[model samples]
Target chain A: MATSVEQPQTLIYVLGVTVIFLASALIGIMYLAQIDISQEYTLYNIQYSSTVSRMVNSPTCFALEESFELPEGYGTETQVQAGIIDWWKFNSGITKVCSDGRIIYAYLSSLDGTLQKQLLTGRDPLTALSDSDLESIDNWNTKQEKYYVLVYKDSQLIPAILEVRIKG
Target chain B: MKKAGGAFLTELLLATVLVLIIAAGFFGIQHIPGFSLEPEAKALIQSVGDNEICNVNLLNLIRSPNEDGTLGDTLITSYLTKDYTVFNETTTNILNQVMLRRWVMNLSINNRVEATFGDPAGFVAVPCIAYVPLPQPFFSNCSFSEIQTGFDGYEINFTTPDGNVTMEIVNQFVTDSDKIGGFGVYPTSEWTTIPETAIIGEPTTINDTLNADLLILQIYVGDESEEVLIPYELTISEPSEDPDGLTEVHLTKKDLVQQCSIALNLFVELNNE
Candidate 1:
């Protein structure tokens, strides 16, 4: 009778050890998975910030005032250059003359938020990005970035915001 | 008694087998679809983070623009006379401490400015020391000699073939002890020495005699080059009435590229402690 009682106790002890071992293994796996996910998110944030910084510092964006040629109806070369600068002050347009990317959209607006222009490549204001993608830009989180550059507007240099969103 | 011992040992063996099976199942979950490790993602994140840090550090080394949008004189002197040994040591420490990697910093300036005025001459070439990192045996295969002891700051001496253009970038920090406060570029050739009084409390001038229609100063920190341009017509005259007047020079958007851009690249490896 005593031997029978001890047999059940040994089985119980063995079962308890097995349960503890299984629980420890499960927790370890979960911890590793969490670590990996955290690392990935950190990396994504870094890439996003770097991309935005690069766009803001691009030389092409800074040299936008000197990028246009004299349009046919815009007087002489000097007048045309001046006209382009003036137009950029209030008008939004896209230029095919991009150094790195396929298209560059230059958005111009006055400080008082009076005038707005959106120029698209090929003289069409439409962009290749879907409406949803463009709308997403309005709801940019801290990850997305926009740079406001001072462009020539009349005699004063006004601020023009340049937002670059590259989609595949 | 023998039968009882056999049964106990069998129970222990069964428990061991059960635990091994459960552990295997838990660990094998990572092998499931969409759960594999992404080494590329981790590397991309690390590289971008490293590059951004390097950019910030390098920009901090440059002189800040004054209230009037002109670089100060002391800043220029410090820039010219900055000890590379100290710079490299500081940079390496920051990078290693922050990044936990063995890395080196390389600096090279490319002054190739195209003439936008007068006769369109070719690029004005400023000879630079090739990419040389401190503590030899790392990036030792460089064309130009490393900075030696007792060496004065960098000197950029260039004269166009026509003798019309003569430009000299002397180490003002070493030459003149008094002009040591602000940062700027004072054109001091063998024939002409710009008085410190001219730049004191005045807008730093890009002398009209330099004949440089456009001057692009490129600072390369690894493979990346950040260029700042000094255009053909950037002259701010001294105030006639107030000798202590400040000349406010307006900088266009084009000038901001050089001032704001941080272009530095560094290769970082994970430090296995």
Candidate 2:
């Protein structure tokens, strides 16, 4: 009777050990899975950032006017031929080639706060953007992306911002 | 006691075997070819190609002659010999070429460096570099032929040391009903409102001795008075590789125009002189 009782106790102890081992293994696996997910996220973020950078720096942004022919007397005396921008064509070009699911805004402005020309897609044009809107756009929260680049407009390097909201 | 010990040992062995099998499978997934790194590699290659194009565009801008009558370091007014030297140095250094065996620039009155540069009708300027990697091949072997039909523009055929590489730069001019005449002095031809195609460069073929890695830049100065379209096509063949599967990179007329516009704008902005 004593041996039978001891056998039951030993079997129970073995079962308890196996349960503990399995639980630890599961926890270990979960930890590893979390690490892998984190790493993949980081890699994806890097790739996304690079793609956005390339888009911003693309030559299409600074495309010149179809023709640089000046009006008869415009630059005759100075002979200074400043490159002109075909704003409408450029806007369309960027829209067609830009990655989908992202809102893009391009603006040419003077050094002062005056807006010259603004191109917006995927959002309504606000006559004036409030500070809060700018904040939300810049912060990018979780699913959105924002990038700003400067292109030379004549002698001035004008700032152009591209904001994208990632899609599922 | 012996029976219990054997049972315990067997359980331990089975658990160990299971663990090993799982670990092996987990690590084995990474070794499969083209699984993890192909996307990254493709992205890198594309980035490199774009960078190369940008570099080449900048070099072209630097070599272009300034429009003003005053001659700074502009290549247009300089002696043809000096122009050749500058081209050689720039191409060799910027392109990282082993040697620029041959170089040529064909210019017309419309696209000449400046008004004073003179109208060189059918003039082909060849560089004076002495470095010839191979004996000059016969020009007939690499002459420009109308191999394919339906293309309204000019085509040039050349054989690189590696193999045959064909490059064609075409510009189609569409009449703008709103505007009369063409850009500058060249007006649209009266026949069918279709502007006559202007071929600026000479038909020079690359000597087969030249390096396989070649850089070709086709600048299409379109007629601004009307809508101008430029289409550029390049086909490259690796002699060592299968000729049947030729690699070609085509930039549609629209994209080519955009590239030219962007390049010109950037060139103007970056011009220090």
Q: Write the per-residue lDDT of candidate 2 for residues B1-273, one digit (tens) a residue.
A: 666676566666666666666556555645776444334444443343233323333333343332432112333333333344543343334223211112222222222331122123432222211111111232222212222221324444433322343444343223223322222211111112212332123223322212232223232323434544232223222212222222223321213222111111111111000
Q: Write the per-residue lDDT of candidate 1 for residues B74-110, one digit (tens) a residue.
A: 2222234663443444444333333323443333233
TM-score of each: 0.30, 0.26
Report residue A115 deviation for candidate 2 (angstroms): 8.6
For all candidates in order, the CA lDDT equals 0.36, 0.35
Candidate closest to the true structure, highest DockQ: 2
Each candidate's DockQ score against the native complex? 0.05, 0.05
lDDT of 1: 0.36
> What TM-score does candidate 1 get on C-alpha atoms?
0.30
What residue pairs are clashing in model 2? none
Candidate 1 stretches with Cα past 4 Å from truth are A1-11, A27-54, A63-108, A121-144, A152-155, B1-273
